[model samples]
Target chain A: MTWLRLALANLRAAPLTSLVNAALLALGTASIVLLLLIGEQFSSTLARDARSIDLVVGAKGSPVQLVLSSVYHADVPTGNIVKADADRWAADPRVAHAVPLSLGDSYRGFRIVGTTTDYPALYAAQLASGRFWEAPMEAVAGAAAAREAGLVQDRRFAGAHGLVDGGHEHAGQPYRIVGVLQPTGTVLDRLILTSLDSVWNLHGEHESAHDNHEHDHDQNPEDEHDHGEAHEHDHADAHDDARENTSMLIRYASPLAATTLPRQINTESQLQAAAPAFEVTRLLNLVGLGLDGLRAFAGVLILTAGFSVFAALYGALKARRYDLAMLRCLGATRTELLWSLLLEGLMLAALGAVLGLALGHGTMELIGRWLAASRGVSATGWVWLPTESWLLLGLLVIGVLAAALPAWQAYRADVARTLAG
Target chain B: MTVLQIDNLGFSYGQRTVLRLDTLTLNEGDTCAVIGPSGCGKTTLLHLIAGLLQPAQGSVAVCGQRLDALDASARDRFRGHHLGIVFQRLHLLPALDVLENLLLAQRLARVSPDAKDARRLLDALGVGEFARARPAQLSQGQAQRVAIARALVHRPALLLADEPTSSLDDDNAERAIDLLQDQARAVGAALLVVTHDRRIRGWLAREVQLEPPA
Candidate 1:
């Protein structure tokens, strides 16, 4: 009780230094917590979304790119495989179901994925409003896509080419929003879903108009057609191409299909097959390398903080030499003196650790709210506190050792000469 | 029985010998004053008796236990249990209040003195009103009294004072000497005061002067 009182009194005497130390510890702890939460959320989201699909078949490129484009709707596909090849793979005995996907268009920066109704059932997505697309030009919106673009059922928008800054209007092939999916806390929530025929038709119509413009220039050189005539020709061709299909999404009956089908397709046909689980593992490895680097950096920071604690206690000992000698004169044994100094440091570290925990949790909660609003993902904040407990315990141990070094020095001080001077 | 015994005790820092005492003994309840010129080893002899330092070629015994035979922690423990020390500069911990500073001594000695005893000790020292004030907030004479209160709080068997009157005027010095002596006599402890000042030598029961080393 006496030592505790002394420790508390010492802290109160130097509130500014204590506060500074606590703040630094809090900042480091908060960074570690935030990074851990975000990394866990990202990895778990990828794992959960990739669990349902056994294989993703798309154009030949990076397997990671294929999964990102076909399943997650994150990046553009390398190129398209013929719809005829997709129909052939669906007929294979090992295949459970096949859902075709066409990408390359966007609405307001969100990638528009042209996929079938089978995609929602495969991903186990629930419809929050209306129904899935039933027609060529109709679209189903993910929760994030709908909320971000303010697209309700029956609202129409002209799809653009690619996910770039500008857009080339689809002329007559305007898409009507038919359904909005409930938030799945995955990347799927940020994509626009529609029939693969829509994307293929949009591109096909684009190519036909290019040919028509050249034909018009060759045939009618003297009489120039008005803007309305050219626009009508583009629309007519767009409607005609809307019935043709593009690439397909495949789900295997077992894990063996992921290895067998992609290899078989690449060998037997022009189509490419991608395994989402395999690609996700590769992705995790990439992310893990970065996380390991950050962990090393955090290790250095904690080491520096430990040294700072040692330096602070050492300086305090020097400044308080007379006080220690006085205590020695007042019947305090060297052991008691040393223990009192050690207790002071332990108290400082414990207080800083507790404050760091609160600060980390508070910062995580703030970030979780912002992420939930902007990215439509509810980051789990509770998962980080347990890991932070280990960090706090480590800091406490370092603090004790740091304090002991100075206390030992005080124990060896010459009491009589120190008092005399 | 003698509470403290020093025989042929010699100590030095580097090449110079600062303290050389042929023989000294303090019986229980005796108040002895040690006076000397500047650079004389009066404080060093007190430190030797308090077990704060090792003697060069002789031995110091407090309460029948040889100081040289104990390890650092044991020596410290023995000092806390048996010796009370007052310094010329009045070393009270700046972080602790007057009462807390006094209580710290009892705590280090592991002596459980009650609040009533503390109050009585403070009252007897004439600084009871400053009990709650920090050492820095007290006047010089009040801090000196607090130091005296701290030194005697554990009821040690031997009390060592090193020029405790250096910061006090004649009147305060006389009062401090009387209070310290009265407290030592009340607790039945031997008092050894080392001082260069000669004003309060008559107050002690006996006086010893250290000449030059030769």
Candidate 2:
């Protein structure tokens, strides 16, 4: 404690140099922590939303974009797959459940998804207020969409002609909100859910198209089109179906489905099937490299801060060498002089670490709030990683190493010659 | 009472012998001045007695304890408890106040720090009010007095001052020598002053002269 006072006095003597070193260290630490926070939140959210679904069959295009669009609702859809084709998968012995999504319109930056009651069941999205829609043009608002857009029962709003906001509004055919979903903490929280007929009608398609979607979506026991070929079922009707271009979601019934299903659909059919897990992994691998680059850049900044501390102490020692010599004469051991320098370096690092951690978390929180407001995703929080703790320890080690040369110099200084001058 | 003694003392800087004192002694409470030329090794002889430098061929025994037989650390401990040295330059720590400067010496010597003794010595030197002021805040004379107070803080048996009056004018120089002798006598310590200034020669009854080394 006695030595600490002396070290603090020395630090206080040169305030500007100490502050600059600390600020640089804080900047480096903040960057490292922020990077980890972003990486963890991003990968976890993707993994969380893609857990149950196995394959997404869509129009032939980018597989990653298919998963990103259908599974995560972050990109443009790969067009549409036939609703009957989705039903054929749903009826397949190997398939557990198939959910179809019709995308291409949004309200205030939130996507309005036209899906079945199974969509709400998939995400466990219970209605927080009012009932789930049963009729065309009646919509259930997602928690985030409701809260952000101030959506309420009886409120009518036109959806623009894109997955995201601001393409062109279908102002004449506005849909009324009947329900608001409880916060499910998934991508479902950011969508407005309705029946597929509402979507076709809103786009001003033929009225019979809405009746066709509603008709073909259920069990058509007495159908005139499929009386002879009962086994081929929805597949023959879906070939001429206009909804063939729309994207469809598929869930695997067994592990065998993963190996056989997507490959068969991609190779043998006009549509493509992309696994969410596989595509999300590939997507993150590409993004991780960029994040790693950013983290490495932050590491370099911390290294430079270490060098600055070393230079500051070495330079200051030239002037204070006499003080050390005098302390020796006053009966202070050489080791005490050395420790003073080491302790000073440690003090600077401690200040920087504390300040850096605060800055790092504070910066993350600011970005998180912005993301929630702008992107409708909460990606920042007070999450501590073991690596961050290790990073702090590494910083302290750097501080000690930075002080070694200066402290050793102080220890080995020629006291007789120093005082003689 | 204990006294300072040196026999066949010799100290060298590389090939050149800087100090060689065949015989030197000071009894208890005695006041003496060592007068010498610039290259006569007066300071070197003082360092030999203080156990700061090793003599190549002689024994330095202070109060019957052979300093030459002690190892570096032992010699340092022996010097700390038995000898007080005041350097030519006032090498007070700029970081500490005047009182802390004196207290630090006692602390480093591994002796119980007595604030009362330190304050009393500072009071005797007329720098009592500057006890809390840093060396940077003090004038040359005040810092010099503080340095003297630091040396006498532990009240060692032998007090050594190496050209302590060299930077002072005649009036201040005489006053400084008087103050050093007065404090040494009060503490029952033998005072030995090494100086190039001949003015202080008249103040001391006993004087030892060191001729320039060959």
Candidate 3:
């Protein structure tokens, strides 16, 4: 108790030094914690969305963009894959299911993803209310989108022009909301899902709807479904059903299928195949490199903070030599004097660690709110990272190291000489 | 019973011998003063008896315990429990009030401090009203009084005051010496005052003079 009393009194005697050191420690802790939170959240989101998607088959443009658009539901489509080309891949024995998506419209910043029921089935998404879209001009909202729009069953609303909010509203064509999905913590949670037929009808690209329609059944010789659609309103069409789809998301039937399918499709046709696992890994590595550099920068800052704590305590010890001598004269042992300063350092760091954690998590919450509003993805930002304990331990070690030199000086204080004058 | 005993005691900083005493002894309830010329190591002799310095040649026995024979920690504990010290420039802790400074002595000695005793000592020294005042807030005389109270609060058997009157004015110096005598008599402790100041010489019944070594 006496040691504690003297230590606290000593620190109280120099409040400015204490506050400065504590502030430095807090800033160091906050930056490190913030980096960890954002890094973990972003990477895990990438990994989770990439896990089930095996490959994306799309037009011959950027494979990276095709993968990003199909798997993450972000970025513009890399032009359209012909319906026949998409159907040929979909009917392959090596492919488990090839879900088609027609994108390019949005309802309140949430991407209106025109996909078949198999797409929602791939995510195991269950409807929280109403039912999945089964007919043309019907949409089902994911949990996040439903919360944003707050639409009731059978509510009719027109979509916006582009893939985000604030686009000019398409007034003439309107779709009825049929259902809302439960939260899945996947890309599906941010989408307005519907059958691809709704997209074709919305764009007036369906067989009967296209102004100058043409059906080329000879193009898909292997597809049994196309045999009945041989007849064509064979006028020159500006935008036809043949060039309808944005991309096709492919799931392989087995591990063996991945070894040959991507290269086979890319080489044999004008379409490109991008495996989600490969593409997402490449993307994260690029992002991780930047984050690693930031972590290193944060490490340097923390080390500098440790040095700041050291310099402050050492300076205070020098100025308080008279008081330290008095303490020794009051029968405080050298060990007691040493421990008091060491405890001061630890206490400063602990205060900083706690305050910094709050600051970091609070900042993350603000970012989460902004992202949810802008991208419709509800970020789980308040994550207790597994590495948090290690980070805190490192901070404490820095604190101890900072105080050690000052404490040693305290231990060797010349009580007799200091009190002589 | 003798409270302090020294025989052939000496101390030095490196090669220069700072203090050497052939023999010095103080029994219980005795008051004595050591006066000397400047640089004759007046303060060093007081420090030797208080276990703040180990004699280079001989042992200092306080309360019949050989202070030089004990290890560092035990020597500190011995000093805490059995001796009180008052310095010329009073080193009162600025953070603690007058009462807490006195209580700090008892706490360091591993004894539960008696607030009543501390207050009574403060009252005896005429600084009882300022018990809650910090060292910086107190007048010089009042802070000196608190320093004396701090030394006496732990009920030590030996009180070593080094240059206790060096910085005080004539009247305050006389008053401080009188207070020390009264406190030592009341506690039944031996008092040793080391100073080169001549103003305190008339009040001392027994005195020893030290000259620098040739």
Candidate 4:
């Protein structure tokens, strides 16, 4: 038998120890691999979805919440900003491009976004079939939205009132699906796009009813009489600029707009401008602490695995001294014996590496499926980050280092003394 | 043809000499016993012949190649091809089966695996039925037969056995010596048995005695 075969046989002879060491290494490797998968998918998905849009302008609230609602459709909007104010900003010379987002409804938990064709253009989306919506009540379904909700071209479906399912459905005001978008691998894939008037007209009567009902309730006199007039005055101001959008996604015309525009909007208007790049960086930084903690835990596990491998080899070597001498008597060179021991360590590491990678990717795919089901944002396991290769390299190094002492002992062993003893 | 020649060989550990031999020669198909009490360096003589140690003085040659003139690795290669040693303990690797033990011997000797020859050798030693049996599963006699088969599988120029029959009864000891002589003659190898067991002296025609270090 070759030295490698001998090494493998030796490992098989101690199946439990070999398996435990391999499994420990696998656990550490899988953890690191999973972390890389999630971290890379999160950042890359965020980057891809937010590439075109520079800033999100919305009703005064947290900039992060505005970006989440308007750009990602992940959270509820901070509230609505007047469409007239957004229109004036879009007409500004510094704004290169703008898309109005009138969000507030969902169909089967997928958001129905009121946007112009420019929204699809923002993601460079293309039609899978049919055409982009050209009129009110005509909708273009994103790929995921189309597939999930069964929104085939020419089909009509009404949306629920809120961002989530189980809300009141506007059954009478159903929209015709004019087109289905190809998968852009972006946030747009989870949205249904329509003319802004579709949202405004649909909410028109509902808004007035809600306003008057609140007005009557305020006049109840027992319910805080001091705010009754203030409530009515606020309703009148809302009616004066009745057309409103949840947010405006904007792209700057020049680098100067980056410096002045968000500050200008925040100070001069009743709106908050959130830079997607800045918000994304802040988001990653916020999540970085947890990622770092998991990374450190993975490092500790790997270190422990290395130590366990060393201990196992050292222990086994002590028991196998006679075997080594026997091999020497059988004509094996000292180097050959040394390599046999080294091969055992490397084989264990190799087994762990293979098992770890498969476990990591499989677990990530399961998580991706769950995330896709709930949030409409999936992190795929199919992606292989470059750092994963480095992970394998690190494991091999650990295997070698763990085996080094045992191999040296085997090499330096006095065969005659050992055999006689 | 002469298979082993030792002349004025000396070996030491630190400040003490362990072994000194004036001259000894053995030819192909020859059987000899180096007999002595314990600590008389009989095993050391086997080691020196196997090129497992560098002699401090004079020369030990196997198949006409001087072992002391070779580098460590070269000596290892020479020993692998020319020498087969059976330790007193019959140290068969527990991980390998009886058959794999023979195969491993061939592998370490850098000889191409001849499964037929290995199996035939095992059959010759009356351990053919235990070919697949692990060393731990074998009786002491069966393990000894397997160890002998492993040593002769590659057809070495010289076969060295250290206390091959010390653990056996008189009948088994005579049988062990007969097996060694027969196998060595079958492979045309010079046979040298190193033992403190005086019963072994009567079994072999040619004998040499090693006195304890003074």
For each candidate, give the interface RMSD after superposing the true interface residues on Cα: 1.7, 2.2, 1.3, 1.1
Compared with the true structure, what per-residue lDDT tens digits does model 1 show for residues A37-117?
677778888887776787877667787888887776677676776554566677687877777666788888888877766
Q: Candidate 1 vs candidate 2: which has greater TM-score?
A: 2
- Candidate 2: docking tier: acceptable
Docking verdict class for candidate 3: medium
Among the numbered candidates, top TM-score falls to 4
Question: How well is each residue in B35-154 modelled by candidate 4, as lDDT tens digits?
Answer: 888877787788889877778888899999998788877777778788988888888999988899899899888899998999999999999989899999999999999999998999
Residue A213 in model 1: lDDT: 39
Candidate 4: which pairs clash? none
Worst 10 residues of 4 chain B by lDDT: B71-80
CA deviation > 4 Å runs, candidate 2: A51-54, A87-98, A117-126, A171-173, A200-265, A268-270, B1-5, B23-32, B49-51, B61-84, B99-103, B112-121, B152-159, B182-192, B202-207
Per-residue CA lDDT of model 2 for B1-214, tens digit only, reads: 5588878888788899887788888889888999998988887787777766678888788998887788756666777777788888767877677887777788767778899999999998899999999889888888888888998898888888989888889899999999899998888899999989999877986898888768
By lDDT rank, best first, the candidates go 4, 2, 3, 1
Pairs in steric clash, model 3: none
* Residue A182 CA displacement from its true place in model 1, Å: 2.1
lDDT of 3 by residue, B1-214 (tens): 9898888877788999888788888899888999998989887887788777778887789979998888988887778888888887888888788898989989987779889999999998899999888899998888888998998888889888988888888998898899998998888778999999988887866788887755
Which parts of model 3 are misplaced by more than 4 Å? A82-97, A107-109, A146-152, A159-172, A183-185, A202-244, A251-271, A373-375, B13-15, B202-205
lDDT of 2 by residue, A1-421 (tens): 5578778878886899999999988999999999998999898889878877888888889999999999998899877666555555556777777777788889998888877777778777799999877667789999888988988887899988887667788887788999999987788888898876567666534334445554443343234222112234444554234453257677778889887888878787778889999999999999999999999999999999999999999999988987787666666666777888999999998888889889988888899899888766777657788888999999999888889999999888877767666
lDDT of 1 by residue, B1-214 (tens): 8898888889988989988988888899988998998878887787888877799979999988998899877787788888888877776878778787777788777798556677688898888988898888988777777787787888889888888888778898898888889998878889988989889778899988887585
